[model samples]
Target: MNKNWSAFNIVSVVFGFTFLYLPIVLLIVYSFNASKLVTVWGGFSTHWYSEMLSNQGLMDAAWVTARVGLLSATVATVLGTLAALTLVRHTRFRGRTLFTGMVYAPLVMPEVITGLSLLLLFVSIGFERGFWTVSLAHITFSMCFVAVVVQSRLVSYDMSLEEAAQDLGCTPFEAFYKITLPVILPAVIAGWMLAFTLSLDDLVIASFTSGPGATTLPMKIFSQVRLGVTPEINAVCTVLIGFVATGVIIASLINKRRMVNNARTDADI
Candidate 1:
């Protein structure tokens, strides 16, 4: 019975992974297809990739998306780190629970609601919808993710390190820069990557907030997707999947290297 259960568990795991990844795998495969219709497979060709490069409008949207991701991720990371520090390091504050709820509220809120609220806010303030507005909206939601990631890391971190740094006569800011920042740096980077990925993948929020001249890649893809699935969309999907996969692989490698280094240090000790 135990052996049968174990086999079932293995099958379940495999099915789950296949279910999650099969669509992405198929999309990447279709990107190289010679057929214009994304559903039908033709002999492999690099035509879509070449077309992706030459399509000026798509290229421009991609560039805009990249810029938005970078800017929003950076801003979100900074703000989130500060918020995390405030939540974790500070002992007491009025409405702390309220603050925490607000910080994480975005993660739970429906995307349509968030987008609508932001749209209303922008319109009420007479802020023109454009790249900057989109960036601002991205930052609002992305920062919540960063705060959660950093907060989790900070919970496991040794506060004694910062105390020791203070004992060595470092100012609070200096101690944080020298001791706390280095320790939490990996989590910060992971948070930034998360924010970047979220910004890049955003469609609903970007759609509601973006202006005519500042359409993001996802927004552009979504608009086109309504028409019909095409090889061009598949090509874009393939590129995005490549980026996500690359980031995951690199993060895994870094973590593995860190574990090995820690094990070696333990052996030496």
Candidate 2:
């Protein structure tokens, strides 16, 4: 196949990326604007960044979002990994179709339906809507995302590696931990990051499940945005973007380094 870049391909790539990223670029630019008006540029300044320090509500919401994202992502990663393993490795279980359907249903379900269902479940169980409830809702939805991510990697995975470890007298659990887990660690990490991002950016489910004093960053941002867009909101979004980008870059670098080291070790052997 010819790999030469065609004129149409070049135009499409340029148009697609600009369409996707131009809004984010503008938002980041506006975050540093000295003007109170989001659209009008008085001058570039970091005043809003400084002002964010004194915003107690934003700080509190940030703390809650961070905690919820971390906890939900961790729990979701564990549950999703196990679910993926069960689906991939044990194909003969009873109700396998039902289980797979349940795992996938949430992915296509609307946010409003998921939120309402969770709210009703909590209410019926007499579980108060609050921080824990919000976390639980996040975990419930995010695990499916993790499962999807890990399951894709598992599909192309070499099962012979795990079987070899088991044949060497390793227990089932030991084989999985020693061989399967290491090979799929990249996918697991990717799933956790995706779950964390979803939890952090979620608003509808959090709104339904959260109570007093459990407001997340997305909830707080939505409340403020309903009133009007402001430079402060832009600033907050910029910070969130920066944090996520930094994390992704760091993870990529770490994974690349690990791969290089592993390659070197294999060459030595």
Candidate 3:
């Protein structure tokens, strides 16, 4: 904690960040390489980025990934929040333990098993695998993570505020919408972001669930990597990483602003 501990603090911070970001930095840098080979960088160029954008297959996959991530994350956040509310509100309901277990079981389950189980269920029901199936699979697993994030906040939430609003003749939905939602918006946003990132980065589950015309970005890059990692791949990855980083920064800023506003309102009250 001491600023006087300069050497130890400097070493720790430098090492920690270097360990985490060096590979990413290298990857980003190489994405601009003029050479075709990923490792042998000739000089800086934007050709790879141009090529990556021009590739129809890659662009289509990116579009599918974006749509799947958006749809699944939104739905997962809604369902997960509802599940968390059930756990937090109906604390004494019958079969609550079983329900809780079912809701959260995916968090600890192996991706392979989850994917396979979903595959089997789909097959049994005669459902076709495609963009919809991939999206469904992502939603299935991502909701559990959202529930975990939301439940943590809900557990510490002040329910009296909602009850007070209801006592003032506000309907349950109105009370929740006007009072509870603003307070928990940050957690919901965080959960949505987590679900989006998970769906975006998922390879294993997507592999099992995806069918023709449903190839995700990760799957595309992975399948191509078997041939070789090219500068184009690096460019695509850099773009994906940039997109996620931007989203996280924007969400964090919004969450902080909301928290500050809530604090000011609370102080006035």
The pairs that clash in candidate 2 are: none
Off by over 4 Å in 3: 1-6, 267-269
Q: Which ten residues in a row have the lowest lDDT in candidate 1?
A: 1-10
What's the CA RMSD for each of the models?
A: 1.8, 1.8, 1.6
lDDT of each: 0.92, 0.95, 0.93
Ranking by TM-score: 3, 2, 1
- Over the stretch 78-153, how does candidate 2's per-residue lDDT look in tens digits? 9999999988988998999999999999999999899999999999999988899999999999999999999999
Candidate 1 vs candidate 3, TM-score winner = 3
lDDT of 3 at 55: 99
How good is model 1 by TM-score?
0.94
TM-score of 2: 0.95
Score candidate 3 by lDDT: 0.93
Runs of candidate 1 with Cα error greater than 4 angstroms are 1-5
lDDT of each residue in 142-248, candidate 3, tens digit only:
99888889889989989999999999999999999999988788899899999999999999999998889999999999999999989999999999989999998
* Model 3 residue 10 lDDT score: 93
Show the lowest summed lDDT stretch of 10 residues, model 3: 1-10
lDDT of 3 at 135: 92
